[model samples]
Target: MNENKEYFVNEEDFIVSKTDVKGRITYCNQPFLKIVGATQEQLLHKPHNIIRHPDMPR
Candidate 1:
């Protein structure tokens, strides 16, 4: 894990992302992109864990 900074989503905002039953990302909304700092192309078909922070508890 590298040095990562946290990005916050608004309390009233909804961050939408969809994953397959196997836990691979299938779709993600713009708000999800902003928070993850990733482009749609980067996220498509990726594992949902791609955006997980190293500091996060397992």
Candidate 2:
């Protein structure tokens, strides 16, 4: 079963990412990878939405 979990970020924590014109991830910072629980190899070139929460509006 899938569970919905919320993650909190600190004020000093800054997540940065860059996506291509097609919304594919091209660049992401260390904080982004850590928060998303993904490695650079896994996230690069993948759709940015892959990490989006289901509750988020389109």
Candidate 3:
């Protein structure tokens, strides 16, 4: 089953990621990886949208 949950980041926490011109993930910081529950190996070269929230506007 698909589960919906909310994750809150700390006020001082900063999430950072970078994508290629084609929108493929190139780099992501540790905080971003933790929030997305993915590893560098899993996210690298993948589409940035792979971690987009459903409620987010396209």
Candidate number with greatest TM-score: 2
lDDT of each residue in 10-41, candidate 2, tens digit only: 74478899999999999998888889999999
Poorly placed runs, candidate 2 (over 4 Å): 1-13
TM-score of each: 0.72, 0.75, 0.72
Task: In model 3, state the lDDT of residue 27.
Answer: 92
Candidates ranked by TM-score = 2, 3, 1
* Candidate 1 lDDT tens digits, 1-58: 8998999867438889999998889998888899889999999998898899999975
lDDT of each: 0.88, 0.91, 0.91
lDDT of 3 at 53: 94
Better of 1 and 2 by TM-score: 2
| Residue 29, model 1: Cα distance from true site in angstroms | 0.4
Flag regions of model 1 displaced more than 4 Å: 1-12
List of clashing residue pairs for candidate 2: none
Residue 36's lDDT in candidate 3: 92
Task: Tell me model 3's lDDT, rounded to 2 decimals.
Answer: 0.91
What C-alpha lDDT, on a 0 to 100 scale, does residue 15 get in candidate 1? 89
- Higher-scoring candidate on TM-score, 1 or 3: 3
